[model samples]
Target: MAFTFQINNELQFNHDEELLKKAEECCPEIKKETKKALHLVKLIQDQTQLDGIGTSILEKDIDQLSDYHLKRDDSLILDFGNHYVGSFSVDLDQVGSPMDAPLYIRLKFAEMPCELNAESQDYDGWLSRSWIQEEFIHIDELPYTLKLPRRYSFRYVEIKVIDTSPKWQVVIKNPTLITETSADYSRLEPLSLEDKTLQKIYDVGLKTLADCMQDVFEDGPKRDRRLWLGDLRLQALANYSTFDQCELVKRCLYLFAGMTAENNKISANVFVKPKPLPDDTFLYEYSLFFISTLYDYNKAHPDLAFVKELYPIAKKQMDVTLKMFTEEGKFIPDEDYPVFVDWSNAFNKDTAGHAETIYVLKQFISLSHLVEDEDEHIYTKALNQLSNYAKEHLFNKEKHLFVTGENEYNIASQVWMVLAHVMDDETNKKIMNNTIEQLFPIKNIATPYMYHHIVEALFEAHLDKEAIALMKKYWGKMIELGADTFWEAFDPDRVSYSPYGSPIVNSYCHAWSCTPVYLIKKYILNSK
Candidate 1:
């Protein structure tokens, strides 16, 4: 369509979408000197020459502003040495998100070639979607310097910018305050006070739950966004007695089914982004391998066709995982030596050495038999070897706990000990009871993440009532705090705490914590 539109609703101008689009594409390309710079794909043009605003002469220099002191309402009238650079205002309030406050800049470009580089001392806001610099940028044509001075919403939005290109045009967007008048979760179906209490318990338990599996879900690759496959299974497990429990399980089974292989090899990590460090662990490989077994149990009994469809991927990852272990009966951490396992790679042959490796090996061994349709020799042999290794190196028989040699021995190793005994009822019981006794005396037994492990051990032992009580107690606290999703740690006080100080990074809307819901539903109430 030939361009015909009113500028500012009064100044008439011909509008051609086709010409503008073509020009927009071409302008940014000319300015981009390298492939990386082309990421922004900016275009520039000298529209003043074409528009004939040759007489709009208006330049107002107040010289009252100091560096980094641009006011939110401030406007710089640029005289095109002709007609005034179309009057542009600071619209800092345009971005939406609670975290973005204090200051931001939005510009209305006057169809001209323009480049802006702020001074080094200019304070840059944190760039996540939640809290800080959340402004949206738009430019229409080439040589389009913004139409107004970079007026920021902040009282001191330090822009130590050194760029002086004969001062083009830019307009800073104003800050808009947003008031959330409605209560949280107001749109959802109203639950009775009792159901509301149950929801609170679920929320609280889930936050702690997320903290428990923090290492597994957040430590993987960009492509592995679905690490919550296990958590989904956990959610199904947690809601067993509720009316929605079955549906939850069905959805979980479908998601887990998607995660599995036809041959039954589960990918250990749903998300496994790699990094350079002392350790090179393939943590996801076996974690998913273990999770697949639980998923298989859900898949087999329900006969959910979606779950049946997921079995192959589980089989494939399983096969690939087992193959990683050597014929000499060693689970080589990876191709690399001196390997250390982090959250995703739970086993490392070098740093964790035999003890840690054996812990993960047992999970794989037990899962092997539980999931296998035929002979269990492969797993049995692996278990026997790991048992022998643990007896020889890892066990501190006197303390009745597995020690990390000398590395600040803690409860983590103890939890893994009980987990190792998953295949042996006697061994599991011993570790479970002893660990509980040890952890009982600690202050705040309600700490969600640690409590999750305790609940997991008890669940494994069929101590449903006890686990449910603890879940209820902990969840009650989380509900009072108004958590829409979950946290990286279980805040019994429901306090607003940051997980960034610790090892955890991703905070809101996690995947691993979803397991508590699964645990409560499946094992406690036996919903399936």
Candidate 2:
């Protein structure tokens, strides 16, 4: 996820020790399982695979890994059979004469085969190179278990003997990955779907969520492993339907509530390692999501006291968001805290931002009632003012679609407006039908985050057929392109497009993309 990286050093933040202590109280124990390398594989050029790269399993038996003695330049790739978040270790022994030189080896970890094909040196994107999962090691002694100290999210590991003197070759064996996650898959009841494709999509989406369910819901286990308020909202939704790990969600809520700017603004994301520090980066919608998350949590789990405790933080968020609107309810977005509808800047988000305000404002009002806030009546008026402004100025009745800056009609504006219930049911259906006729084949836009909103809008408009088809067409395409899990960015128009100019930094298993679990359970199962 290549977000706008901004650091505001002058921003003063508050750290509520009580909230932090509660977060610590809710911390989950890391669940783990050991997995062995299933096969030895060869990376090959294949058009069928994603990024024009695929893996071919070698006939060599994994049990006899030590048979293939590795000398200078000899290399092998170990297939872990599935993607996992954890550490890897392999036993190494000297198979030749006395070891004349220290064994220098290079290990490259890949979530997918294409990542292995992409040369790390060629990646000069905005993301830090240190996040790249590749390491070079020099082993001075023999008969050592090469246990990588750092955790990795991957399905494949390529090991190369940079130099093992002709005197003795290095023998490798017992390659194992200790997988880690806080999600309990055993809790899920077996789901039987008539459509096999939807079943696969659901399973993949579940795995995507499971892998990212660490101590806190990480946006991506491979990169940006932190609790993002926006991502947490979706992850918590999916978790409620599947893992039902409400405590993790509660902990994440406190983590954000514990650290906020003095203006009552929550950070876009927070790092939990060493100490919980909110990111300096901020986004318009992400901060508002704190209220949405708290609201959703109350809906799913329903604890009046829990809601009461977090209500003030959620209200503070709503307060900050309310300031962006004019007395007439016009939303003038600030550049410093831009509304991130998606990673793409190709489309204007003026109308969508306004609609999101309505979406979260409604959520906040519901929360306000539960907490008995005296200021609750104020938001009820603001909601009407916002909805009125949208219907009067933003919605183009003639075109039957919402308009953004420069009269640019886009999918995001319609999706968010539909979600916010800016109009009556009939009007929503009409707007969505118009959207389908004009924007059937989604292009330029990617990010499952945005795709989720579009699919949800279709469902909200009662266009079940269109909604399922879009889900199949967009997310199914990811499965077709070899997705073990969903991606952070994907554009069917440009299948290989990466926001950071390289697929290496693209997050394959992302939090926002894993909502199929919630969608399937909420829409499909409930319909039946």
Candidate 3:
């Protein structure tokens, strides 16, 4: 009764043996995996130490402290190695439950493989290397023995452990400053439940992404057109706050290539002809962005050998895009096979080709950065061409905002102009700000691609605070309205659409929207 046919669309669980038997005929592996996951979930629940601690700290305990803006909690403790991190509350007026008393806390490790490696895709990989919280809590019953160093200030309590891990970037923000000296505790704070809960959700998202990509690889690219999916997977990973999580994305790409010529476009083993060489400009553009993100990972963590392995693939893809530049001096969007041609569709622009051209060229610029051996003059020329075109056609000196292409300008076109400036500073920075100002006043509007351009532009301009505020205000609203995941647009009314049905735009758990959730979670929350 808990799960009927309609309710369980995925058929994730079905106790009916007869139905299970019939379903097993079609996807035995799926049924088996589902059952295994269910079993694992149950087992993990029983084993997690945090589960016990969480039970003790009822929803009531949290509610009582809600008014205090309790940022750091020092009473609770988690022993990782020779250090401990936990949450505690503040009694500013010295009037609250457990007031003026030092609370002792300790937690045992609930899961094995306490450390994560970039290449490993196991469950533990999602655990935060520095400050990870688990579903289990096992609070100790020891009485507080330490005396208060300063009365009416803070009664410091220390939780000690012996960490066997090689590195400790994890930190406790508060009480540890008074009690411990081994690990850093500068950025620690008592995380809100919403934040804690959301972090877990993102970890699941990370795990889901990893599993999906592995399946795409296992199924082979020929059947799934995995290049697009791979690009999406890595993009999602790139949005993660932790450096280690980002490395996982690069490692997966490397694993998929398996020492094959990193440059050649690959299809899953299931494909008939290996994706037919990506004979279109879109393929080059899309692949280039992915390559650039990987390059960034390599630049930051040079020890990641997989990034080096991907260099050839990156160089080859760049060459394909660069070759598309015409002998007559224009980069044409046209391609022979045209596997992934996209025209700006979300918002009105002046002209399709005009606006689309700027978008493509900017992506190419990002691609240029990923390929180290490439000449600066090559991309410099492309940047100049795009900037000149924008200045001539899109710049509106009077309004200070860039005008849309041949058609009326809308959110989508502004996004393109903003991104172009961010990528190639050849364009006027004033125009980028102008576009952002016009777009900001428009309420309840969000396009996944447009948001990306805005964030990228703001970050480039060092407007981190404004960017965070914008994402939280507009995009954050979208998240509140049942965004189980991010959506393509702001769907306050929950409108649905179909791209093929004469521009019927609606929602059904789109991919672009999901990107926003990844971004906000990574940047604002900075969750591990």
TM-score of each: 0.46, 0.98, 0.45
Q: List the residue pairs that clash in candidate 2.
A: none
Q: Which ten contiguous residues of candidate 1 have the minimum total lDDT? A: 29-38
Backbone clashes in candidate 1 total 85
lDDT of 3: 0.35
C-alpha local distance difference test of each model: 0.36, 0.90, 0.35
User: Clashes per prediction?
Assistant: 85, 0, 41
Question: Highest TM-score, which number?
Answer: 2
Q: Give the winner by lDDT: 2 or 3.
A: 2
What is the RMSD, in Å, between candidate 1 and the native fold over all Cα?
A: 19.0
Candidate 3 stretches greater than 4 Å from native: 1-248, 251-284, 303-309, 323-331, 335-377, 380-396, 420-429, 436-450, 458-466, 473-479, 487-494, 498-528
Instruction: In model 1, state the lDDT of residue 401.
Output: 56
Write candidate 2's Cα lDDT for 399-426 as tens digits: 9999989979999999999999999999
